[model samples]
Target: MSDRYELVLTCPKSLEGLLAEEAAGLGLAEVRAQVAAVQGLGDLETAYRLCLWSRLANRVLLVLGRFPVGNPEELYQGVQAVDWQEHLLPTGSLAVEFSGHGSGIDNTHFGALKVKDAIVDQLRRDSGQRPSVDKLSPDLRVHLRLDRGEAVLSLDLSGHSLHQRGYRLQQGAAPLKENLAAAILIRAGWPRIAAAGGALADPMCGVGTFLVEAGMMAADIAPNLRREQWGFSRWLGHVPALWTRLHGEAEARAAAGLSREPLWIRGYEADPRLIQPARNNLERAGLDAWVRIYQGELATFAPHPDKGQQGLVVCNPPYGERLGDPASLLYLYQHLGERLRSQCEGWEAAVFTGAPELGKRMGIRSHKQYALWNGALPCKLLLFKVVPEQFVTGRNEPAPSQARMIGGQLVERPPAVRTEPARLSEGGQMFANRLQKNLKQLGKWARREGIECYRLYDADMPEYALAVDLYRDWVHVQEYAPPRSIDPEKAQARLLDALAAIPQALDIDPSRVVIKRRERQAGKKQYERQDQQGRFMEVSEGGVKLLVNLTDYLDTGLFLDHRPLRLRIQKEAAGKRFLNLYCYTATATVHAAKGGARSTTSVDLSKTYLDWARRNLALNGFSEKHRLAQGDVMEWLEADRGEYELIFIDPPTFSNSKRMEGVFDVQRDHVRLLDLAMARLAKGGVLYFSNNFRKFQLDPALEQRYAVGEISAQSVDADFARNPKIHRAWRLQALQG
Candidate 1:
C-alpha cells in the first residue's frame, strides 16, 4: 500500500461548486465539480485540511476502492477484496452508509449490511479478530455510493454531518441548516458581495443562520473551526502531530481573517420570539459583536440610516403555506415591492422563493433568476437592481388631504382634528407606542447589522387582544378604537375606521394596506372570525398592477409566524407526496404542490376551509394531483391512513367547535397527531408539524419512535422575517422497527 493516496471529497447535492472553491482556496490541486461531489488529488494533510475547513459539505469521503458492480453479491465481493488491514484496525468499530440508484443493490440498508459482513469476515479471517459494528457513532465511518452502476467506497473523514458546525449554542424555530445556508450564500455569490462590501440581509432570519453564515464567509472563517471532532480523528491512520499542526495553521488563518465589522449583516422580525435565538446564535458564532438583529415589520423597513449608493437586499419570506390565502400573500408581496421601491435604491435585491408567481408583484424585471434546490423543492432566486430615484419617488401615493407643489417641493396640509386624543384609548396607545419603539429599534439594528425586514410583533402579542393576530403591510399607527364614553357596538366600528386611517397617518397609500376583521364564527358565536370583508386595488408605486382583498375566514388574511416553514416546504416538497394536515386554506399545500410535488392532499374538518383550500389551489393554477377534503384528519388517517413523502401539519392551539369534534389543543394531543402522521408516512418521508402554542413539548416516547429533526431554520421566509420561534415546527421521519 502507498503511504499517500489521491482522495475525492463529496458534498450534498448542489454544493459541489462551493466544495471545489473551498478545496482550491486551500491549494488543493485538480479541484473539479461533479454531480454531488468535488474531485481532487490530495495527500493525507490535504484531506485533513479540507475536512477541517470546507463549509459547504455534508461529509469528507476519502476514496478507498472503486469498481463497477451489477448485483449485491458483487458489491459484497468488491468490499471483501479490499486490503482491510491497510485502513481498518481489526478491533475498531465501523459503520457502513450507502446511497445509490439503478442497481440490483438498490436497497441501501441491505447493501450496507452485505458490505459490513464482508469487511467483518475479511478482518476475522485475516487477523482472527472482527471489528465491532456501531451504527450511530463509529470509530471508522465508511461511505459507499453507486453512480450509474459504479460503486465507490470511501472512508468518511467527517465523523458527524458537517452541518453540525458546533457554533450554535441554541436554536429558535425554523433555523436554517448551516451547510444549506452556506450553499445558498455560495449560490447567491455571497463571497463577491462581501468582497465588494455589499450588505447581506435576510428579512426573515430564523436563529440568524443567514447572518452567521454570511459573517463567517465574509471573514473567511472556516466553518468547522468550532467543531471539536471529526471522523478522521478516529481513523487508525490519523497522525496526531499532523492534525495538531493543521488545526493550528487553520486557527492562525481564521484569526487573521476575523473582522472588526468587515461586512454589513442584518436580520429583522415582527415577533420578538426569534430575536433572542438570532442573537444567541450570532454570539456563539463569534459574530454577534459584528452583526445586528432587530424586531420590526418589513413595511416600515428603511435603509436611509447608512449612506451607500447601493447594497444587496435578500429576503426569504413565507409562501402562503401554513398561513392563509395566497391572495393575502400576494398583497404582502405587493406591499413589500412598495417598500423596496421606496426604501432600497441603488441596491441589488434577490428574493428567494418557492412561489414564482409572487415575483410578478415586485414589478421589476429580474436581472437573473437561478433555479436552485433548498432540498427537494425547486426554488427560484430572483435578482433585481433598483435605481435610487425610483425607490424614493415611487413610494409617494395620493394623500387623503390635498397637497401643494410649491417651488418643485411637495407640501402637506393637515386637516382639523376632532381632538380628545383622537379617541385612541390607553391600551391602544400602549400597543402603538410599543410597536413604534419596536420599529425604531429594528431600523437601527438593521442599519447596524446589514439585515432587513425583521418582525415587530407576530399575531400572538397579548396587547393586540386579537384572536387570530396579524401580519402588517406597513407598521403604522392611527386612532383605532373609540373613547370610553362610546358604546361597545360603536367602539368596534370606530376601531375599524381608525384602522382604515392608518395608511394616511403613516404616509402610505390607503390601497396598499389590507385589513382582515374579527367577527363571530358561525355556530361558534363565542369566537369571532376576523375574515376579509372587502376588496381594494392598489396601483403599484412602480407603475405595476396590484390587488389587495380582505373579508374572509381569517382576520389578517396571512399568518406571518410560519414564514420560515413555508420556505422549507417549498424547498423540500418536490417529487414527494405532501399531506397537509389541518391545512386551513391550504396555502402552504399550494406552495408545496407548486414546488413540483408528485401530489398533494390537504385535510381539515371544516367545509368552509376545505373550499377555501380549493380556491387557493385554483389561484395558483395548481390543477394537478392536488385534493382538498373536509374531514377530521385524525379520524381520516386512522381509518384510511395515507402515506406522504412530505407532510405539513399545523393545528389550532385551542379550539372547541361543534362540528362533531372534541376540544382540540395541540399541546395536549401532539403525540397522537404525530403517531397518526408517522403511520401514514412513506419510508424516508418527512413530516413538518407546527403550532403557535408558545410552550409546547414533544412526547418523550417519540425519541424511540422516529428520526426527528427540528427544522425551524428551513421554515423562515421574508415576510415573517423576525423571531423564528413564534411558531414551533419540526421535521420527523419514520424509523424502521
Candidate 2:
C-alpha cells in the first residue's frame, strides 16, 4: 500500500467541471471542480489510475510545494529553497512548463526558465552535479502556474499532453485534437450513453476521433494505457509497487467490461485515406476487435442493419468556411440533415458545424446547441433528439433563461399588394429585369470568345432573387426565388418585369441567348443532378476533339477553378503515365492524354462519372487505349503502385454517399493519402494534390520528408473568375537529384 496524497487535475480553460466528474468517476477522493482544475485526494495508486484514465485533462500535476511569492525574484528564491535531492536525482533530465494569468510573471517562459535555473543551481552547489534539460523527452517534468500574483509550482505527472494517447501511429486531414475530441464528447452528453448501452457513430468520421473517444468511454479503458511514457514515471517519489497495482486494477476493470456488448463504435468515410488510420488507431487502443469501420457515404448509410437501430450518430461535416464555396457546403449540410431525419430517425445525433448560416439549411431544428472550439475557430455542436413524428415538436424548445421585462411592442412589415401586378418599383421588378438582360448579353459574349463556361453576372439581380449563368452551347437554369402568390397573371407580370432588365444590367447582346426556368426535380435525384447545361457538345481545342456538356445538370461544363491544373497536365503529359483520382469527368486526364501521355488512367467510384469521363476522353480525341476504373481509391491505389509519372488528386471536400462509398472528407487523411500517391509515383515523379478544405493543415511530417510547394497561383485559371484561394493546390516531388 502507498501513502495517500492530494492532487489537482487541470484542463484547458472552460473545461473544469468536465474534468472533476471524470476524476470522481475514477474513484478518486474528495474530487471537486475548482476554477480551472479538479481537486482531489487519493493514494499513489489513485494518482496512477487518474493519469492513465482521465481523457479530458491537459495534464496531471502532483502537489509538491506551495509558497506565496509576489515577485519574480521571490518566486525563484522560494523555488530554489525547496530540497532538490528529495524529489529528483542530480543526473536526471528535467523540463519546465509554465502558464500564467494576471500574475507578475507575464512572460511564462522567462518565469519558468528562472525557476529551472534556480533549481539546477541549487542542486549543483549542494551535490556538485546537476540535471540536464530535455525538451523532447525528459526524465522529470516540472510545472509552474501563476494566477493573481501568486506562483504555484508542482511536479508534472503526465509528461506530454495527455491527448497524445500514443495510439495515433498516423493521422488524417484535419483530425480533431484528442483532448478537444474528448471535450466535445462530454459536451455532447456521451457519459449518459456510456451508462446505458448504445451504439455511437461518426458519419463523416475523419480519422475517427469522436468514435474512438466514445469507444474509450464505453469500454472504461484507461486513456493512458496506450501511452509510452508519463511524467510520473520519472518522479522522485514514484513507487513501482503502487504503479503496478493500479495497472492491475485497470486491467481487471477492462476484463469486467468484456462481458458486455463491446461498446458499439463505428466510423464511415468514403475517403479511403481515413480507413487505414482509423483501423490503426483502434488497434493501438486495443479496440480494433470491438469497433467496426465502414467505407461509404452517409446518405446511403442505413441505421437499422440486419441487427437493429443504432443509439447515436455524431457528425463533424465540412462547413466550407475556409475552402471552396460556402453555398455548396450549405447544400451538403442540408443533405446530411435530411439523411439524419429520414435514415436515422430513431438514433440521436450531434452535429458539429462551424458556419451558422450553413446550419440553418439542415431543416431540422436542433434540440440543444453548445459552443466549442475546433482549434481556434468557434463551432456549434447541435444535438438532435431524433424523435418520431408523434413525439416531434414544431420548434426546438429553448433552454430556460432568467426573464426580463419587454421594452417595446413587436411590429410587423406590411405585405405587398398583388392586384396592380406589383409595380416595377425602383428597387424591385425593374432592378431584376435589368440584371436578367445583362446576364443574357454576357452569355453571348462568352460564346463569341469561345469561353466554355462563364458567369453572366456576379449577383447582379438581388431583388428578384435570381442568378444568371452562361455556358457554351446552352444557357443555365438560374437559381430563382419562386413567387409567393398563387395568382397566375400577377406572377407572370412579375416574372416578365424581372427578366426584362437582364441584358442591360450585365452589358450583354440579347440576340445570342436562351433562358430556362429553375424548377425542382422530383425526389433526391435533384441533389445528384450535375447541372442543366450538361447537353453533349463537341469542340476542338488545339486540334484535339473535346466533348463538353451544355445542359443536363448543375455543373456539366467544367470546373473553371482547375484551369491551371489542366494546363499543368498538358505541359507534363508528354510521354508519361498519367493518373487522375476521384476524376470527376476525367477532364485533367483528357488534357494529359491529349498532351501525348503514353497512358492515362482515370479512377472514380461513380460509374455515372466514369461514363462522363469516357465521353470527355473521346471528346478530346484521346486514343480509346486509355484506362478507366470504377473502384474504391484505397483498393485501387494499393493494388497498383509505381505506375504513374503524374497523378492528380483533387478529392471532393464532402459528400454523404455515392453509389460506391460512404462520406468523403479531405481534411481527415491527406498525409497517408499523399504517401500512397508518393509510393505509386514513378521514380522522381510528381503528384499534384489539391483539396478545397480551407482548414487543411499540410502534415509537417510529410513536408520534412518530401519537397512540397503551394501552386495555387499556378492552379487558378481565368475561368474560375473568383478568388484563387478557393482551392489549395500543392506540387509534391520525390526527393532526389
The best candidate by TM-score is 2
Superposed on all Cα atoms, model 1 deviates from the true structure by an RMSD in Å of 23.5
| Tens-digit lDDT track of model 2 for 1-737 | 23767688877665777788778887778888886678888877777777888898877887766777787788888888778787788998899888874436778778878889988999999889999999888888888877776667888888888888887778876677787788888777777876776778787887777877787778877777767688878777888888888788878777677556776677888888779988888887778877888998865665554356367888788654221133335346645665665566677788877765455446566788777767677888787777645122232232334443456745443222111111233553457555466546655655565555655443344435444455543334354545575464444344344443333344444332343345443322333654443447665443345555534454444665676687778888999999999887788888888788999999987777788888777665665669999887766787885478899998766655545345445676677678887888888789999976668878778888788998887776443444456588889988775
**Which segments of model 1 are wrong by more than 4 Å?**
1-6, 101-103, 169-174, 259-262, 304-310, 388-737
The C-alpha lDDT values of all candidates are: 0.67, 0.69
Clashes (N, CA, C under 3 Å) per candidate: 46, 51
In the range 1-737, model 1's lDDT, one tens digit per residue, is 55555567766676677678888887578887988778877788888888777877777778888988988788888998888887779998999988886568667888889889999999999899999999887888888888888988899888888888887767765455788777777766777878877876666676778788888888867788888778877777788999899888877876777744456677877778878977988878877777889997876676543435356677777754421334346546655666666566567777877776566556455777777667677778787777634332233443367578999999876432211112233454554555555556555654564332234444334324322122234431212233356675544433433342243333345444443433323333322343444443221211112222234334222354564565568778889988888887676776687678899998887776666567666666776689887777777888865678898888877667776477766778889988988888898888887876668887878878888877666666432455456567787887767
